[model samples]
Target: MSGTTWAAIDLHHHVVPREYAKALSKLGVTEGLGVQLPKWEASKALDVMDAHGIARSVVSISAPGVYFPAKDPTSAVAKQLSRAMNEACAALVRDHPGRFGVFATLPVPDVDAALEELRYAFDELH
Candidate 1:
């Protein structure tokens, strides 16, 4: 494999958008899936990717997802959160060009809203 160059793609990457974190904090959610939430920053992620020789990473929100236990799964708040997160991911992609891609967030349990967000993510964001 001498002189070979590899462009790696990381499919399982997680991102905690700033706004999403704040929203979760406001809702008194400081952790997810029995672990403390990670503080994700784009510069740090990029540095790690460079060290790992990763050319691109497709990122999504981690556990606890978009549904808050205190709020109904079908609540508008979930939809709003999903939209905000997806938009944030899209921004990352836009800002980083080939370095980042988004695994769009959806408001699950709210079928209609999820579908709407899916369409928006693919059509508008992409």
Candidate 2:
């Protein structure tokens, strides 16, 4: 058996970019899951990864996803939020070189927006 060791890849990493956190704050969503959203720093993330021997991390938006104001069944806000998060992720990947990759969040229950975002993320962002 040829056993080759490779650096760890964290598939479930979450990065709440500074801009995204501000946007949420503007929307009055200060907390989710009964706790305030914690601050995140890209430099801190890299440090932790380095300490833990993780070479790459695929980042994604956390729970409750892009959808907000749950009463709005149209998912309009979800689409907008998803686009912002994806764009931010793309920027992070651009800035971090090989250290980060994106899972690409989609605005679910809104098929058309999701499809459009999928195309943009794969074609342009990647």
Candidate 3:
């Protein structure tokens, strides 16, 4: 091997965007799948990535996805929340280009809305 090193790309990284956390708090959900949510900050995540020799991390939301409790996943609220989360992730990628990337969140169970978001995430956000 040559005297060169390559950094790793983490595809399964998780991120709890600020707006998403606030929405969850409003819904009285402090945990996901019965486990408490862990604190997250982009700076901290970047620091950890640097320490681990990770070149980039593709961040996405962790479970208890978009809808919560008895809320219908097809509802407007679900679409709105998904959009907010995706936008927040986009912002992270925007703020720290090359260091972060996004796995856009979709409002699942709402096919039309999901399609719309897919288009927006690709055409607009990209």
Candidate 4:
């Protein structure tokens, strides 16, 4: 299974810094139970890939895709979450090389943050 190949991009994942995840946890989102969905770890993601024979995964922001405001108290927290998560994504790609890719998660609903993140992600990261 590990040797087998399939294109994949588990972009809609979350393995952010603990504090950030906890803050998100406080927001409390779930399908039905109302329990906060636990953060998704990169190792768990990779392990799943190993099990499923997925060759690679492009990690990116899922829904809530940074609709969080970039101002307020939560704004900094949101920005930190966004930055930390994106950095984590990059690190995952770095660790896995060709097996992984990452898309920047901007603190959005904020056009300024989106454009800023875009410039940074494309210009600097590229």
Clashing pairs in 1: none
Predicted candidate 3 versus true structure: per-residue lDDT over 29-122, tens digit per residue: 8888898888889999999999999999998998778865375534777888988988888889999999998888988877888999999999
Which 10 consecutive positions of candidate 4 have the poorest summed lDDT? 29-38
Determine the C-alpha RMSD for candidate 1 after optimal superposition of all C-alphas.
1.4
**Model with the higher TM-score, candidate 1 or 4:** 1
lDDT, candidate 1, at 72 = 58
lDDT of 2 by residue, 1-126 (tens): 479777899998987776677777776777767777778888999999999999999999765467775555778777878888999899989999999999988988678889999998999898
> What is the lDDT of every predicted structure here?
0.89, 0.83, 0.86, 0.62
**Candidate 4 local lDDT, residue 94:** 75
> Candidate 2, after superposition: displacement of residue 78 in Å?
1.5
Residue range 24-65, candidate 4, lDDT tens digits: 555653322343445667678778888877777766654444
Q: Report the candidate with higher lDDT, 1 versus 3.
A: 1
Q: Model 1, 35-54: lDDT tens per residue?
A: 98999999999999999999
| Model 3 weakest 10-residue run by lDDT | 67-76
TM-score-sorted candidate list, best first = 3, 1, 2, 4
Q: List where candidate 1 sits over 4 angstroms from the true fold.
A: 1-3
lDDT of 3 at 21: 76
Off by over 4 Å in 2: 1-5, 69-73
Return the TM-score for candidate 3, rounded to 2 decimals.
Answer: 0.93
Candidate 3, residue 82: Cα displacement in angstroms equals 0.9
lDDT (C-alpha) at residue 117 in model 4: 74
TM-score of 1: 0.93
